[model samples]
Target: MIKKEWILQKALEQFNERGYSEVGVRELARMLEISPGNLSYHFSKKEDILIALLEQFSARNSSFYEHYLTLSPTNAHFLELMEKIFNSQYEYRGVYIGNQYVRTELQSQDRFDYQSIATKRASTFQKIFQGLDAAGQLRVNGEDIAFLVAHITLFGRFWISEATLFTKFPDKNKTIRHYLFLLAKQLSLFATEQGKKSIEEFSRGMS
Candidate 1:
């Protein structure tokens, strides 16, 4: 990879392995075997790197949102979309792991627009819920859909942080399957009869 890309990748590795606050810019340069001056040329401050990493995450999530718009309308497709969401979150575990740190740091800066990030994420899930409801794959009514969307969004966003409290983190596929299974259970509670049938079949196939 190029120098700038390599810096971001290595920085994420450090952030994920340790907490973001525990890693400093000079330490990052040492980890990279480069001069602190070289690192500063790319990212003057540690927060600058964090912001850049978040921008990469935002692009990924936008791509995920756009992919959903092209999917066939079915409960299965919704699950597929959900899997993509989970996969992206796992891929950027450092971001979610440091969700609080990132938010507090960014919130102090006027340029971050932190609320817009949360708003866009909520709107995306709301659209997904509305789509599923219209397709008869979900039982949520108009008012309930908002609550359901918020519920799913909150769970998906913070799940990694919660998972860290476990005695040990499971293997990646096992972790993802467990998450998917839990999500299947959650959706079953509000699924239409047809939706329930679809989710049951999906769950069995997943097993």
Candidate 2:
């Protein structure tokens, strides 16, 4: 039973590392040192495994966002929250990458299930933005709208896979950081003049 759990966990990691289509269920069973029948016993199909992984991802990310929102508004909090966007992208990179490994997994799955997952994942983000808005720290339109803005903040950096990203520095981590800095700089302007002045004063002191 413990070995079975380890195999399941590795399957999730392998799905991410190599993508879903390339990683055959039979091979996964082999790697797990188990019969295909056993894996099928727990998860009837590969699509079933993908759905379970997505569900776990959704719950984990939602809980994380909820915890982050409980923190008071601060530039650091804002930055951390934005970093989460990349982290999420990396976790689900294959979903966005097309005509390849990730695309195959998506095609094998139910479209309605994918749509529902997207909607549910989006709500956690909306709540986090709403928290910031309630504290008068955000300059965005509304929580729902703001969620879209925040998500789009990383548009240039995301990839279905590294191949889809730029060649010079395929890693999007640096690009994501640049966006986070830009976001905090622009959003900090929402503070009162005195608050803004204090920020300037701090910059001067640092200089």
Candidate 3:
């Protein structure tokens, strides 16, 4: 029997190394040293493979949210969670870099709902912002909190793509750390004095 997990692992590596559209089933099969028919036995189409990959992404994101829900309302907790979230995103860089294209293909296949994913992300971030506001870490009022949540969500979604434009150095770990630092800096700008101190202390510890 074909091992689905092995196909996924190899596919993820290929997707990350080469652009998704550039890697066809034949190319993937050749890379894996398996016949295209063997891959087809497990995944009837490329969309099938992509859907499987997206399912893994969904599960990982759900796990992140579950752990995030357990965090105490503090700037330090938030920064730490930001680090985890960004690191996870970097692992799935293919998703961010070609999100629209992936979603479009998945939608065309009637196998994915991008809007639901987007809605869930918005709701999750809003809750995080609400927790921060309740803890007095956020200086913004309720109205601004909504915008701030959306702002951060947008940044997280597109940060990898943005990094690509100027990240000529190509150190993946350093890029992830830089983005996390940027996230903390953005939040610090809208933080209360106590929150700012917490963030500063967190930064010092990292350095």
Q: Which consecutive 10 residues in model 3 have the weakest lDDT in total?
A: 94-103
| Structural similarity to truth (TM-score) of each candidate | 0.90, 0.65, 0.91
Query: Each model's C-alpha lDDT?
Result: 0.78, 0.58, 0.78
lDDT digits (tens) for residues 109-156 of candidate 3: 667776788789888888888888788888777888788878877887
lDDT of 2 by residue, 61-171 (tens): 666667677887643564565567566656565433332654466766563265565555566556655655566655456754564555543342343344444442345
Q: What is the lDDT of residue 89 in candidate 1?
A: 74
User: What is the C-alpha lDDT profile of model 1 across 1-207, one tens digit per residue?
Assistant: 238888999998888777688899999899899989999999999988888888887788788779878986567677777777777777677755246887788778875675787788788778888888888888788788888877787778777776665633446667777888888888888788988888877777777
Model 3 vs. true fold: TM = 0.91
Cα displacement (Å) at residue 149, model 2: 3.1
Model 2 TM-score (2 dp): 0.65
Provide the global lDDT of candidate 3 against the true structure: 0.78
